[model samples]
Target: MAVTKPFDTILIANRGEIACRVIRSARALGFFTVTVYSEADAGAPHTLQADRAICIGPAEAKQSYLSIEAILNAARATGAQSRGLAVHPGYGFLSENEAFAQACADAGLVFIGPPASAIAAMGNKAAAKRRMIEAKVPCVPGYQGPSTDSGQSDAVLLHEAEKIGLPVMVKAAAGGGGRGMRLVRQHAELLPAIQSARSEAENAFGSPELILEKAVVDGRHVEIQVFADTHGNVIHLSERDCSVQRRHQKVIEEAPSPAVNADLRAKMGAAAVAAARAIGYVGAGTVEFLLDGNGHDFYFLEMNTRLQVEHPVTELITGLDLVALQIRVAAGDRLPLSQDDVQLSGHAIEVRLYAEAPHKGFLPQSGDLVLWRPPTGEGLRVDHGLHESGQVISPFYDPMIAKIIAHGATREEARRRLVVALERCVALGIETNRGFLVDLLRHDDFAAGRATTRFIPQHFETPAAPVADDTLLNIAALLWFERAAAACGHDPAASWSSTGRLGSPVLLQYGETKTKRLVAPSGGNRYRVQDQEIAILRRDGCRLRLQVDGQGRDIVFAFASDTLHLALGVRDFACRDITYQPPAEAEGAAERELRAPMNGKIVAVLAAEGERVSKGQRLVIMEAMKMQHEMVARVDAVVEKLPVKVGDQVATRQLLAALNPAAE
Candidate 1:
């Protein structure tokens, strides 16, 4: 039976892509949209998309998105409550906070998610596992005890680990998403692993509670999307395989896993439904499991009581808008489809576009995005919060900037189309994993549907960055020449025969390597650099059409100061013009400087002034992009200066410590 509309205004109590996603669905359903933002996101896409936007607090999440009081105040100040409002807590910040859900209920506002009781039942891994065991769900064998901060001694955890055997997973009981997780394979590593995981958990999730599970090696990460309503209707919308990962975070996801057959899907789907029902779950949630390689046995991992980052792939395959369904269910409407009514269509694949350098251990990067152009196609969808070029990708949020999804009649077609779409994507000024995603999709293992959770580690463990070849160097030189000519009040596309036969020497640097080349104009729109001849056929903003040594090529490029950021095919290059600059300084003392890898807050400082440290010893630990990074000593040296302390926010390349060589 249809009920009265519960709300007319929907307030998105989150930021970034997810906020934008909810706004689209809420507005489509004729609901007035309200969004909240931090000071950093004053001009963000989500804020701009909403009919009304409010600034909750500063950039820090605790003071903004995670603050229940601030969100409530914003809702009240905007008169959302007077008009009947529902708060849509987009995934991540405060999405699964039971207290926040109860607070909304106490304030006579509808929380567009599972009930507070359900969230509490499933939020803690230890409690959830105990409950699932009682509900007869197959779970990995291990220990579920009190947290370290809650009087659970280390001895008890160690004893449990020994009983469960080696190679166990230490996980945060209060959170998911791979944060506060560690895999311990050796006896000597268990203690450190537990400590590290506990610390990270306390910081990321506000809880130090932990659980142990038998490490399921070489298993496939599969999750089932389940939805329920107040009318006692629950259905699973197929399965998604998120096996390809790094640092325990999913990189690629696809719906209708290749490993699961009809029978297996039914069984897994039933188990997922059971898990949700056991917790009295409502709205959208995901039941994750680790599927064995044999494609038969599966074990429950955890249940995410919120929409997942990879929801688009399921939406594409099932032809459903999960966000819209979430809104409908929150408004006292029964589910539109039953279990038998749900149909999975064509295969769909999605990849996260992160502002990170894959070659450098997937280190998150932050800077002004000089250019942002997502590819458009029939079967492709790009969900992002970036609206225009020159937007700052701040360090206060996750590094994932967008998600690209593709749908096709078959898995191979979907894979192929995703690769092409990724290749066509243009994100410059900041480093990204676009090229890596392309290569991963084309890998023989991935193409054959044999990728397991160990896909990235087994292969591409030390993936190298693409090197700048001689041809690329020549192109950079020519582009630099054209820009220089234009800056001097001359048409770069015109002939440059007036410069004479010797040509001008250009010094270009790619990374730490520099090369000097002689470039001269041969004729109109033609130039000779070294032994290669190039002709510029066309120029459209950053796009260049040229014939290099009789081979026609098209390149996408951008200029930031003296640096030229260009994408030649799938490879990206950032070349700096060092022409007419003195470069005779040698790096001696600079090598002893220990600097922050990215913008983050220092969590630990292990070294002090006047202390001598060995090479490769970890000196500091900082939290950036919701992950911890260690700054290590480069050489055996005496600490000359220790400038930073715990809780200090640091910028990239800022010195954390300075050292001097030890006396021989």
Candidate 2:
């Protein structure tokens, strides 16, 4: 029989989808969920979904989610209201923080995760590598000891790198989520790479220690979901394949890995179980490994002491509620099932929906979601912390908005289901990777389950803005004209406007290109757009049914002061009304300036004013949404102006520096 549930209530010490996800499991188990939020997350979906909630601190994470003192205090204060007895740092903020876990223990509250000691042991990538090696787990050959923070001489470090060979990975000892990692391919790039890695490491994880590993080229990233209890019982769920990535962050994940077979799964699972047993782990954790395509060799990567972002796929395949298991283990229960009792039934795939523009370097985006309609049907699940409208996607945190998961009896069915769901979902107003994800899901390699880590960068290019054909453009022009008439208190469906005389000429601009179309009334709500005759069969707010030149079509459109945004199924188009603007003029060459891509704080100024630099030399570094982006010189030039200093906050397109071209 199962033991009694540990706590009557739990405080979720985080925000966003994962917090809402934890709240759902807690409620299902007959427990009250106390949610803590920052100032920015007021009325957020997670906060409203909680049984009780309290404001912890300001908008910035340092004062809110990352503040151990604030979280503990909130847990205490809400304990009276909701009887909160535990704190669950769902996934991100302090999920693996050893001090936070110890603080929960000190405050006489259960921490729904591993012990503080286990966290400390596996939290450091280098130390975990050593422990796994001692436990007889296979690890990649690299240099880890005599950390960078020890002030080891550059010569000695370079010597170690030389031993590890070129093309090594410089990783932060206590970092995850792709921060503080650099791939150096040559000796000349070692020092700067190490310096940047250390700086990012110290800022992100409070550790400056570095580890070097041989870069595994074109490998599949697979991880096992392992669970443990206080009774010394540990078991491994199946594996997840997370090979598709960008900037070292996962974009897509699925399970069981297409590349992992039964024999390979057993070997990897046994190794993961041994690792957890050796560390005396408890609750939910993940053991990551890099597998070569040949299916012959697998090497241990780092272990995540807390639950992973890709845990949903594993949960789906195994038909288990991982969050509920975490709660039961924290309550000091024994293993619910042994290895023989465990089973995997279905296939599952999940894609991360991020508030980012894939066409523009995948830079993070933030704004209100004007139209948020995710797909709904059988075998599809959307885990999110967003309402239908009026939800703000904040820039002070990660850009990911939701996780879309699909499950099926087979991998092909699962893949096809996810594709259809992505095609049907619509998220508008600000930019997102929605279109790009659809393309990836339909790619041949991805569909065939043959993708590797280099699949995206090698096989895909940043998609250009969708090009509107002549017919589509004509329809858009008509819709714009009708919307303008309606806004000015004129009846859009009136016959006089179209039939009596020539209608107004509408000028529309898409990107930098503009086109003029002459609209005239043909007959009875029917009109001539450019050259094609069209009739309006039906009209609704932002939705219209049109028949163009003997063909029927449906269109969805929204118009603002000077722009029209429309969607036809999965494709979207943006066109501007340039009717009032003057004719285009012949212009000279554009100015050379370095502009910020997103709102962020200036982290470093790498070049001095008047300093001559070659093309592609690093000039500035900006930190936004907890990720760093480096700006480089596009041409051989001298730095003419440096308007922004370190620690300055900048908006999108704000100038950071100016350059005067140097003699070639």
Candidate 3:
């Protein structure tokens, strides 16, 4: 292999977990690494681990990591070797930005992924689809051009809707993560979805152009892994099943899709390589498809010009370090192996651990991680973006804090081991989607390897089931009680009469009920929590290192009475004095009040002081987490007074309105 350029320092122009992953890989390859971060990400895990970290700009992404000049300046300031300043863009930010790719090349730094030309071609689905069609890639029926084009005019769309049958998908020509996509089951649903998709496209990607395609029924998502070098060598690394999704984003992914046998795998792999060669793709890329039953037929979805979030699963099976290969490939080395070199090991599955409440429609949530712990054991690998105590799961960026991937000799074994790993993984403060993921993994269909794109909506209709005993919630609380008892200077074995003056009972709220639990230290790693005898093996400040399953495990708990706090995995729960009674006691305590969830300005209010409204009607829409949450009517009522206007500042649980309910 001939070298195009040679150097030794690599700069990662991104933040979060992926940045950290790159730094580790780069260091292992004998390269000094530089990291760039935003104000909010100054203390991020990746920055802390890098050899040299630079602050680019404010917390907002636009001024920081997305600032091409700022990143280039960091590279130049560090005196990095010209070609050694290769960028391993984790996934987001300038990972797929064609301009950024060109800028890196123009500045004499190697962009580790595909070339700028390849990025531009696959960056927009409409353009990518056209190329796929020309390359003889399996494609769904759709018009790959602007919606306003001659063949896709407004009248033509209506006519095409009739021609393609009822169900169709209106999507942004340049969209990712299911954004700018709408499903129209009939003619009436077409126009509104079209308008919404276009608006979302404009808002998300700065393009209002939309492309329409026929929707596939009972589709299973399967994607192929590809690696190409400057020398024109490309190879596919099998397929990954990513059918489990929410909001059109992958939830769980596994390689060697159960839906794809060797025959179909070969077919899909060949097609992916054909598409990549068509675009002259270099470095790591993915070709996504929607597979129908029997797996013989599939439709090309889109191509991601960088490493995917689920790349770990592929690595686990292939025993290949993808990042190293990416670097060597960028160094102008041909792929060390061919498709024949690829072999299936056992099985692998990955779950995205997010700071979201599954009970709350999987809505993004946040709070400080009182305790953060990643599961570690045989056949288990955890790639985390957060650490204990210092990590605050913010509403900014994606909610996923880490991804846990487990491997086994069998699919069932892999599935079972994943459940065990998830059970042991604990995140306190801010709710996590652990409970839902646990249920989904254990669900019958998932166990049977019979999952589809609509698996979440169809199979898991009731997603609010909390972990019964699998989690150490009770153990953590018990540990907290023991600590709180000691904190208040009370010992149960010494007798309550000895002290007489005791601490107040612990009051907390998981949802709407004010539950009280009395805590008394029983001495010797033991406590009485609501008459339940709980023995604590150990406690480390806020972290309670307890004996979970006779195994030394760490848990975090807060015992402050005024602010009730507990963390069940990654989700945060507040213990407030919100009391609920049998209607009689609740009737008289009405004070017209509106409250905020987190710190944010009120955006809009739908009702006036004297307006009447039905139950569940929108009262106000507050913007936070980059999304709007509607505070609606709990019961039919007449508006008494809205103290705060649309632009008022409010705190969590602050009363924003006074409501007088109409007589039932």
Q: Pull out the clashing pairs in model 1.
A: none
lDDT of 3 by residue, 1-664 (tens): 3235776777888878888888878889888888988876768888889898888887556788778988888888887753466777778888999999999888888888888999999998988999899999999997676545575566666676677776898888885888998878877888878778878999999988777788887899999999988887888999999999987888999987988888899999999999999988899999999897655789999999999999999999999989888888887788899889999898999999987777677777654555677888999999877876547565456778799999999899889889988878777655678777888999999999999998997977557645434233344345444445476796534433345423235543454444555655555665555545556666566655554435565555664433445544434455443332434434433333445565445789888988988877888887656677788777778888777778664545567777777433
lDDT of 2 by residue, 241-342 (tens): 999998789999999999999999999999999999889888999999999767768899988888888888888888899999998788777778998777
Compared to the true structure, candidate 1 yields what TM-score?
A: 0.89
Clashing pairs in 2: none
lDDT of 1 at 285: 99
Give the CA lDDT, 0 to 100, for residue 336 in model 1.
95
Worst 10 residues of 3 by lDDT: 495-504
Candidate 1 local lDDT, residue 221? 96
Give the local distance difference test score of model 3.
0.77
Clashes, model 2: 0
Better of 1 and 2 by lDDT: 1
lDDT at position 238, candidate 2: 83
Error of 2 at 341 (Å): 2.1
